[model samples]
Target chain A: MKKLIIASTSTVHNSGYLEYILPRLTSFFEGVKTILFIPYARPGGISYDAYTAIASKGFETIGIQVSGIHEYNDAQEAIANAEGIFTGGGNTFELVNQLYKNNILESLSKAVLTGTLYLGTSAGSNICGVTMMNTNDMPIVYPPSFTTLGFIPFNINAHYLDPDPTSKHMGETRETRIKEYHVFNNTPVLGLREGSWLEVMGDTITLKGNLSARLFQPGKEAKELDSESVINL
Target chain B: MKKLIIASTSTVHNSGYLEYILPRLTSFFEGVKTILFIPYARPGGISYDAYTAIASKGFETIGIQVSGIHEYNDAQEAIANAEGIFTGGGNTFELVNQLYKNNILESLSKAVLTGTLYLGTSAGSNICGVTMMNTNDMPIVYPPSFTTLGFIPFNINAHYLDPDPTSKHMGETRETRIKEYHVFNNTPVLGLREGSWLEVMGDTITLKGNLSARLFQPGKEAKELDSESVINL
Candidate 1:
């Protein structure tokens, strides 16, 4: 059976995100060949040095520039040859936009079902949900939210954090934002704070992170995940 | 020909909405029978007194008690009897959530296409865009952006106001929010300020309000509108 290691963000350039995943990743993909999907980092500009720096941590890393569908031959080959797929974090909207523009999200989803290991962090984690409509990012842009890649049945609100006490504004809180999503969405949401991740192996899901994930059922108060407990939905 | 008026918000309730529509509405809608769609006012509690107070201002007022698709009978009848329709504002997410659940968004869109005069205010105005996602209310909750009724092709960031001088915080200013939206969204957005109303009289769009409206398009600096201008899609 194939194994998957989905992270919350990439450690390549983001030292903080790297610190969170580097420890757990060594054992998670031990002896397994890893191919990193770096489409999310387009805004940061792609460089061989950057790719090698991230790869130097342990597993072999091959970067896939998935900017358009016409260039998808390499992306398809990458998904086929990889033991597991690691999608880095950047902008979920931009990532999904590129995915749809290149028509690879469906192909990747198919690969996951065929037992190819799937890993996603931050924006990558968000596309796991039913739709990308609930991202905390600005909504001026419209991406295809009809059907997500669906590695997870529910949507992931990555980088979920409590309101900063230092900030003062009248805007609704993150919890309120999730509740707004509940008003129209039947799918439950996983509020994954930074540094937290979900591990999917076979049919089991394990939550790993500092903050407890919060789940909201429509018309009900949000409930916190049990102390490091994994619940099958 | 059927007519419709969607206000920026409900006149009888909420702050920042205009009362100008109340007096003129009765005149413009004279001798025409109508029904007021109160999907946006669900949070304000649609009491009979409140309904009459708004209804007495013009033709006839009726609240849509639609919470879900199960109310198809009432939903259908309400749309059918009214020569025109009106949508009031409270929370855009709540309004869109209820409309989507009841599956009446497409029907309402059809109504508008067939020459139904629609007047929207505040949250009501926010829904006029291609994506109901451009709201300034912050993501207090995640509502479906893909399912907006699509009355207009562009997005609308409603209740556009400058930052208060007396306030201090780290939140992104309204100007900043619009800038972020432009990065990913190619669709132009109009920042409709409070007391402003975008009136559509058969292909004619007039910007009427107390202040100039702000317009943001991808790859361009934000522009302000001081006089009535026709938005050519």
Candidate 2:
């Protein structure tokens, strides 16, 4: 059975990197002694070593050793041997680009399918979907394709924000953007709000955390899914 | 000489469609009897005919007749003979996708270069830049390339928003997204706020409207460009 923790964000407000989710991660990654970190997203243009260090510190609190994929000579071999896999969030385009360039996308997908514990935050969670088409990140670089790991049945809009009723900005709201996505794509989108996540076990996926996520389906009105609700598509 | 009014948005808060900029557009499109409208952006999932009708109504006030490029059997021929052209706001990915599918990217670039008065709002304005890499719209569909008209020297971030100081949203701010873009691209990006625009006449591009715009260059701190300031980059 596949096991995964796809979180909206690694950190909530007023928290350290991965601090808010560390406790949950410890349980999700139970029995895993080490985690192979994929830090290609490079948030704020951070270096790979620096980003890995943050992840390493977070995983250390749970007694798990962390190793960045870059530390290994063979990225594919690293995934093949990883007891657990964690991809950090940054720019999705950059992350997806590096995945294709390193030729580890297929390996990573296979590792997760064969029951290696998987954890993804933001951009990492985004790639767990059918496609990275719904990511809110800027297209800093063009990836070879928008295709992603397809571990999940639907796409995820991580760190999803609710439209502020008092805002005067004329840009499309998150709801509107998803609606536009539906016009071209039939894939359902889960708006994973901050502090929220989806826990996948075998064929069942359940919403975890306190917040209710917004679910958008094609040709239908968007609805909110309460915490602990089974995400049935 | 190229004449262009690249606006951040077609409408401002509490204003009718194009009401705020109609007067400037009247003079900008002076002596032009008819304008070819590209309604490919199709905001709100509106049909091309419906979107074009809105543009037609907006232009009717300026004594110029409007015809959607969709009405023409040959889009390239329509661009070749256009007295003036207007591309309205919608999903940037969809707009660029259609532009590529129709094989009209080169023709549109040619039309604007050869002095067909061009007006673009939001997504339309975004394409006037080197690439549509900086747009805030969702990537509903994959385009052949992020490359655009390249009528302007740099990229544009339309409907540019300022980070909310009091907000607790964890998603990357507009400034952060632009900074991420700079990490991979050296192209300068102009953050055109609603009520701000770029008035391009030949080689000179001046920031218009009452609001100051933000200019972001790679490897430098973002700075605000005052209204009416000439954008040298």
- What's the lDDT for all of these models? 0.59, 0.93
User: What is candidate 2's lDDT per residue for A1-233, written digit by digit as tens?
Assistant: 88999999999998888888888887888898999999999998998999999999998888999999999998999999999999999999999999999999899988999999999999999999999999998887888899999888999999999888988888989999999888788999999999999999988999999999999999898999999999887
Computed on C-alpha atoms, the DockQ of candidate 1 is: 0.14
- TM-score values for chain B across all models: 0.79, 0.99
Best by lDDT: 2
**Superposition error at A160 for model 1 (Å):** 2.8
Each candidate structure's TM-score, on Cα atoms with residue i matched to residue i, is: 0.64, 0.99
Q: Model 2 off-target regions past 4 Å?
A: none
What fraction of native interface contacts is shared by candidate 1?
Answer: 0.18
lDDT of 1 by residue, A38-135 (tens): 44523223343453344334342322221222224676665665566666555455667667776677668777778876667666677776776555
Write the residue-wise lDDT of candidate 1 on B147-168 in tens digits: 4766666777765667666543
